[model samples]
Target: MPLILPDQLIDQEVLNQENIFTMSQDQADHQDIRPIKILIVNLMPKKEETELQLLRMLSNSALQMNIDLVRMDSYQATHASQDRLKKFYKTYDQIKDQNFDAMIITGAPVERMDYQDIIYWKELKHIFDFAREHVFSTLFICWSAQAALYHYFGVPKQEVEEKIFGIYQYEKKKEDPILKGFDDSFYAPQSRYTYVKEEDLREIPQIQVLSSREDTGVGLATTLDHRFVFSFGHWEYDKETLHEEYLRDLDKGLATQIPKNYYRQDDPQGDIIMNWRSSGSLFFSNWLNYCVYQETPYQLEKIKGVKVAKFGGSSLASASQFSKVKKIIQAKEDREIIVVSAPGKRSKDDQKVTDLLEKYYEGKKRARDLEVMIESFRKDQAAKRQEAQEALAAVRTRFQEIVRDLDLEEALKEDLDETFQDLDKTQSKDFVLSRGEYLNAKILARALDYDFIDAKDIIRLKSQDQLDYGESYKAIIKTIHKGQRVVVPGFYGANAQGDIRTFKRGGSDYTGSIIASALQSKVYENWTDVSGIMTQDPNLSKDAKRIPSMNYQELTDLIDQGAQVYQRDAIDLVKEKNITLKILNTNAPEEGGTEIKDQEDK
Candidate 1:
């Protein structure tokens, strides 16, 4: 989507050459769709360049975004002209009354100094505090991430031994929705003198580490709910950004280390690898799609107290099923958290998305050349790779068509394209296996007008293969809140090792139960094909009727006796919490299916 820039101020010819859409005020006034309002508090010295860079990043998404540029009233900017600032920018005071869909606080070149020592620190603190109430989501980049961490959490930043200048590979600490479609590891450029330690972040329970490198420490951290995304590295940097900085430092005779893993053979004159661009694009697009566009309330004022309803993919497999789910959600104002699985089997011979993924995985065989056993032979593996690519392409195309048919945000279609590309770079069996649910969750979120949170991020498991209920529940509680409808994908959770793990068959039910129990929800509605559990095996006895009510004991016995309704583990998770498990049919939700409860409840 296009960024709403001032037609007179922005060079239309330049934007056109770059393919960036800019609308005049007169043009914007007539549009029926309300553009997402984004506020950028540009702190970088080169304000215009930063403006262009940030706009380019925001432009990749399929949201009609309106940009409001702001400059600090208390501080003077030396790099940008006063006339330019006065013409295009507004001070925080001027726009304080208005609420924004999202805001971006860029990095200032003052990280080495104490927070209080900066001239505009006081005003910046006010803006930071203002964001909690006025902005639906805020992104703190580089120094701002550190500043927010210190101001809100009392975390202190320490100067590093040397400038951490380089393109470094960071391990994704958790599977955040922000990092959805991201590989197991990705590279980001970092150039900083001061840093926030991951240990300090751990002290504050609300702060969750999203990504970190072995030596570089925490690269990204955010509040458990992801209302705020803090990026320590420069994911917005262009390919030659580091190289330009390196050259400038060398020209000035400043002490610096060569940016590690950046140049070919560590040679400054050699070709620079643009490794972070793909991940960067995906990161920004996800923030715009999941966090800003979907999470923020349309009326703006309703954002504070929205409820959550999580819908599984099986319940939303078709248009009719989606309509049923929508009706069910409309009946309750407080149900907004949605947990979606990938599309399920429509017929006996039809394939579930998850099943197709397993087949796709099979096509990616590691072929080796006997002559050179050290590495896989590209030529030998070409045919298999092509086969895998074709299978994966079908899955991607299927989801793309669904999203298009549903009239979702254009950014979502772009996301599908990027996700398939990211999937091609991964060799992890589990990562490839989980794309089914991830894509499904995105589609459902768009269809239901709810934000999608990846299960791999919030659902925690121990390194020993046991559920880490304490950490998992804490994270979920921090993330999901009242007045917000969110859909989390099911079937898998990540362990301490960052490996995706799944439950037995019908794990999506298990995932839903965990979310409900954790939140102490009023009821856990498990939507399925059948109305509810039948009196007997329906397949065996045609006379079997839908059971209107049952206790947990009876449900467990039926499941144990091969009645394929609810998983035993799923029942056990929510049974103790007294959360009534309502099984409603997606196709016939109006029929009002069975409600399973404790024996005393009857």
Candidate 2:
């Protein structure tokens, strides 16, 4: 039950004074047991304080643990001693190859800033990616939880009008291993400027909300498999953490509110209420026993894999659908690379954007009408933030540029005769058709706050009808960074002469497959409107049932027989790579969708 830590950790003296049992590496080596390896990616400015708080909570567990501390090497620490960090902590690069039973990423004070603007954001993404493949389970605390939610699922944190700084009561919402103790309601400390909505979390099928409150929103949540745990409240905070935060804020001349329910009679000088300690200890103990110790493989090296998710047109049709796409992407950490199709029909009577573009290209629709449709789509995708508005304007300008040389004699087409002379009609048509996906990817990237990668930049085409796989693989490797969530437009790529060429309609599925095969992803997830492949078309057969799973050969046979659930070429690509394919419903994700895999692998 002793914690194995560095011999001279800066906080060791404080922990010793508190009578927490700790052992040096030399002493732990002499022991016969294989101590659980725990990595702590400490992000709090007060390094020593955070270490003591986390070490105290972890010390309550009966299982012995070897705690390895890590710091972000990309950013220099101003509050903590550089000498101490160099001596007691390791950087991400130093331990990138090592596996751990569990890892804890502490909260930082960068919640208000955009994720990309943070100096160490790139480095932290690598750490997050490493944990997904190497660490058995990861616990994200406060701001880290928000960051992880955004990075993985595209769930953005909304800033509240006031900071939630106090002890709040959260009621148990669901029964799970992470919340094993008996408690209908419990007190936990909350000190944050932002919070994630329970409604948003509920949309993600993979996440299970464990505890929540009317006032505090979501307090605790975890993935259904317990691989990732998110704690919005700081259960590891010391009794005076809030008090110190209040004083610090006041000293800086900022308006500060008294921490609610933390003192007798709401007086700062009154006796402090320490009701959360018992629940906090029980929570950490349960996490160790149930979430980590019982589930992790004895050999840590056995843990490794990644998933590529592709959202179809129907799944990313409207603003609401776009939100669903973000949640699905964020639900699993391994779903790092996202591929998106153009907006589809929002309702039975609605028209897909791609169809509208095609009609305009064929001269069946007016150019003015097409422009109006595109503008409406742009407004629907805007998020009411400055960045989204800016993206909206940029997307509108790009659309205008693409249609500038159109043969239509409208106010939109000026100097059409001169422009037509220079325009290659074939290339212009391909560019116009691809804008549906291009604009959607731009909007989606802004909404999710992820990098936007144009498919033409990486996916290479040998000709209008032929794909260049070798060149595409090399280009994808060169352009995309490992572990970064990026949004890529599907259906179109560039040829050897740098001319834009498009695959046949419904070719986004093929785009996803190529990326999955190029990345060697363990699984390729295709999200559509239906739960899975049905035995018969639901529109025709009232008793149509969903197929839980099928083999690659069976799927190929179905395609050969004219089943239209997936693209035939996409199926061939994934089959050749031996990548497992999952057919998921973006709307009704809880239903176990169909899975396609090689028979031998299954």
Top candidate, metric TM-score: 2
Off by over 4 Å in 2: 11-13, 306-602
Best by lDDT: 2
* Model 2 worst lDDT run, 10 consecutive residues: 415-424
Model 1's alpha-carbon lDDT is 0.79
Residue 496 local lDDT, model 1: 80
lDDT by residue (1-602, candidate 2, tens digit) is 89998887845667778767988888889988889999999999999999989999999999999999999999999999999999999999899999999999999998889999999998887787677779988999999999988876678888877888899988888777777774888899999888888988876645788887766677999976677899998999998889999999999997768998999999998888998999999999999999899989898887766577899989987767877887877776667788888878779987677776665444422332344565665443332333323433333443344333222224334433333223324336687678778767866676677888999999999888788887887787677765678999999999988877889999899999988877756789999999899999988989999999999889989989998999988887777656789999999988999999866444
lDDT of 1 by residue, 1-602 (tens): 66788555568776787677777666777989999999999999988777777887888888898889888999988888999898999998898878899999999889999999999998897787667667888999999999988766568887987888999898877888899999999989898888888888775556689887657778988876567889999888988888999998889998888999999999998999889988988999999888888889897654442323345556666555666776787777667777667777766676777777776787774432223444455565777667777778777766766776677748586878777887777766677777877888777677777877888778998853477877888778877765567878787889887777776556788788888777655577777777788887766888989989999998888888887787778787778655678887777768778988876544
